[model samples]
Target: MKTRKRLRSLGVNMIACLLSLIMLIPIVLILLNSFKTSQAASDMSLALPVGGLHFENYTLVIQKGKLGVTFFNSLLYSSGSVLLCVILSALAAYVLSRNRSRLHRFIYVFIVLGITMPINFVSLMKVMQLTLLQNTRIGIILLYTAIQLPFDVFLIYSFVGKIPRDIDEAAVIDGCTPLRLFYSVVLPLLKPVLVTVMVLTFLNTWNEFVLPLYFLGSSSMWPMTLAVYNFFGMYVTDWNLVSADIVLTVLPVVIVYLLGQKHIVAGMTAGAVKS
Candidate 1:
């Protein structure tokens, strides 16, 4: 039995390793191809690097893409959106999970519909024009917040429902105000789900292109996604620089994902299994 179990474990490990490599192949190819000459990169070949350290493409991308500005813009939009969306969604989730009224149920359904329904850009454009938010960071942040709220609320709501109701009662008995109860007691308890919301929201905002393209007018406010899109146009044939740009764009997401991966897994499973 011991030998059999060992063999099974080894088999599983081998399979897992194979899967990891399979997923990693494209990324490896991209990195390798980025170092190759423009023609080689255009061919998308994975052969050993021929050209020694082709830094020109990277420099060209940096100079034209205004990578520093766009990187900062993406960071601001993603982080700001995450911050606002998570806080509001947490509060809304707690309330929705605890409430049993028809109105609350309707509101919950309406919010969740965002996940199912596609965004109507025309309506959004009109709203933005009305609010004078057509070309600003705050406007873009608010849009992201709205777009992310439904999923965040739903996830956090599900997670919050698992917490014991007795805790709320205890907090009230101690004369804690509703806001205080949430901030002091409930919010900390929802950390796992909150982290999940933050990471997911940040990723979505960071990678978004459509909304930014329509809403933001100034190149100064462009995110990495838009920058990458424009850069691709500028260097359509220069695959080395394009690949390098792709690497730069993806690197932060990889880092953020690795850092918050534990919380992401925990949050994904938090309220799913009753046991």
Candidate 2:
């Protein structure tokens, strides 16, 4: 029995490693080809950089990609969405977790429905136009906030449910204000899940493409993803610069995930077993 279980575990581990490599190969190719010359990178070979590197690809991409401005815009959208989403989600989750009323249950169910529902882009665009928020950063941020709030609330609500009720009672008995109690006591315990939400939210907002293209009409307001289109003309595409742009664009997301990786498993599994 022990030998059988050990063999099964080894097989699973090998398969997982193989899958990881499969996922990572494309990223590795992009990084390698980014350093090659335009002609070399154009071939899109997955081989080593044998033809001496073209370091100018990075500089030219930085200039042509308008990376400075686009980076700021991306940061603004991602950070704004995350801040609003996290705060509102935290507040809503706290309320839902603490109050088991039918109203709270209904709200939670509504959020689940939101999760399952597809975004109505046309209606959202119309609403933005009416509010005079079309083609603006504020509009995009608000859209992101609304879209991300449901998932954030769900993750936090699950984590919050696992917290001991004794902590809430103790805080109340000590005359702690409800707001203060949540911030001081409950919020601290929610760090793992909060980090998870922030990482995932940041990634989604950073790499987002279609929404920004449709909503942000002006070239100056484009995010990194949209801004990369500058490297192409109607006739020719610069693969070298494009690859370099991709590397830079996803670097921050990769770094963030690496940093927060430990918290992800903790956060996801924390709410799995009821306390």
Which prediction has the highest TM-score against the true structure?
1
Q: What lDDT score belongs to each candidate, Candidate 1 first?
A: 0.88, 0.84
Clash tally, candidates in order: 0, 0
Question: TM-score of each candidate?
Answer: 0.88, 0.87
The sequence of per-residue lDDT tens digits that candidate 1 reaches over residues 58-95 is 77777777899999999999999999998899999999
Top candidate (lDDT)? 1
lDDT of 2: 0.84
